[model samples]
Target chain A: QQPVQSPQAVILREGEDAVINCSSSKALYSVHWYRQKHGEAPVFLMILLKGGEQKGHDKISASFNEKKQQSSLYLTASQLSYSGTYFCGTEIRAAGNKLTFGGGTRVLVKP
Target chain B: SAVISQKPSRDICQRGTSLTIQCQVDSQVTMMFWYRQQPGQSLTLIATANQGSEATYESGFVIDKFPISRPNLTFSTLTVSNMSPEDSSIYLCSVGTGPTTGELFFGEGSRLTVL
Candidate 1:
């Protein structure tokens, strides 16, 4: 099943902060975050395992809640380079080697 | 991490023609996957390419329409058969390091414009 992403789009100014949430109805073994610029392929950001852990990249961090079957990505002190569409891909418990991606959240950071 | 390369970054083809997109990985991988993303839409899995065997197509996708070939661990190709306007989309190839975490690395993508 496809994950659900909240706040389809968000605009932030430089040095601002924002959060993108992804929720799945089914139990998730792992949640992966990716970013894609307009007309470009998606780039891998981080992956959260089933253990309900958090991963960080620079000012970007993501946390997965195993009990809630949800994940949240936090962008702190956002920069202009953070402008892109973010997608959360979920790996269901019984779905091996298959990932269902969320609709996506478009983030625009302006200076 | 794997370095993935795709050919024909963008192409314009006629309706009746077929186009084959190629994916190459720097390191050997166990499985490679194909995905399609329509304009302003989320990525959808097309199939899983297995080395020396037939590829598995996802729901709403068929092997006859999108034939795949995984000749080896480092290379795979997805051919769009009998293209149409609806087939105009960005096709991406990805490879997971293993089956455990479902973490994957993706290629830049090949954009096809069917006329």
Candidate 2:
């Protein structure tokens, strides 16, 4: 099943911060994040393992809550270049290459 | 990161017609994935192709409609058969960095417009 993302969309300004949350009904072994700009392929951001791990890439960071089967992405000091749709992919089982992506969160940062 | 190249980045097809998108990778990959995304929509997994085996398609996707061929470790092709306007979307080919890591590198994507 596809995961659910909250705050369907968020508008931010440069130097602002925002959070996007994704939750799944099933237990997950890992959570993966990706960002896609208009007319482009989704780019890999970071992956968080189970056991309440947190990962970061540049100003973007994410945390996975194993107990809750959810993950949250944090955008710190947002930049205009960060404008895009964010997607979280959940891996239900270890070694399972198959991933179910959540409904994306569209983020727009304006100067 | 693997460098993937897709052919015919954009194309227009007539209803009931077919179009094939080719994907080539710089190196051998253990797994290749096909995804579809409509404009302003989330990416949907179509199938997973492995060399020397039949592609495993996700629910709502059938081989009869989207046939995949993995001729080698570094090349694969997805053929959209009997397309309609609903099939008009961006088709992306992604390569798994490893079997367990699950980090995917995506191709530029083939944009198909069916009329």
User: Judged by TM-score, which candidate is best?
Assistant: 2
Each model's iRMS: 1.8, 1.5
For model 1, what is the alpha-carbon lDDT of residue B1?
82
| Runs off by more than 4 Å, candidate 2 | none
| DockQ leader | 2
lDDT of 2 by residue, A1-111 (tens): 899998899999999999999999999888999999988888999998865899899999999998998999999999999999999998888755577888899999999
True contacts kept of each: 0.55, 0.66
Could you tell me which residue pairs clash in candidate 1? none
lDDT of 1 at A108: 98
Superposition TM-score, candidate 1 onto the true structure: 0.95
Q: In model 2, what are the clashing residue pairs, if there are any? A: none
Q: Candidate 1: which stretches are off by over 4 Å? A: A94-97
Per-residue lDDT of B1-115 in model 2, one digit per residue for the tens? 7999998899999999999999999999988999998888888999998798899999999999999999899999999999999999999999986868668899999999999
lDDT of 1 at B113: 99
- Chain A TM-scores of each predicted structure, in the order given, are 0.95, 0.96
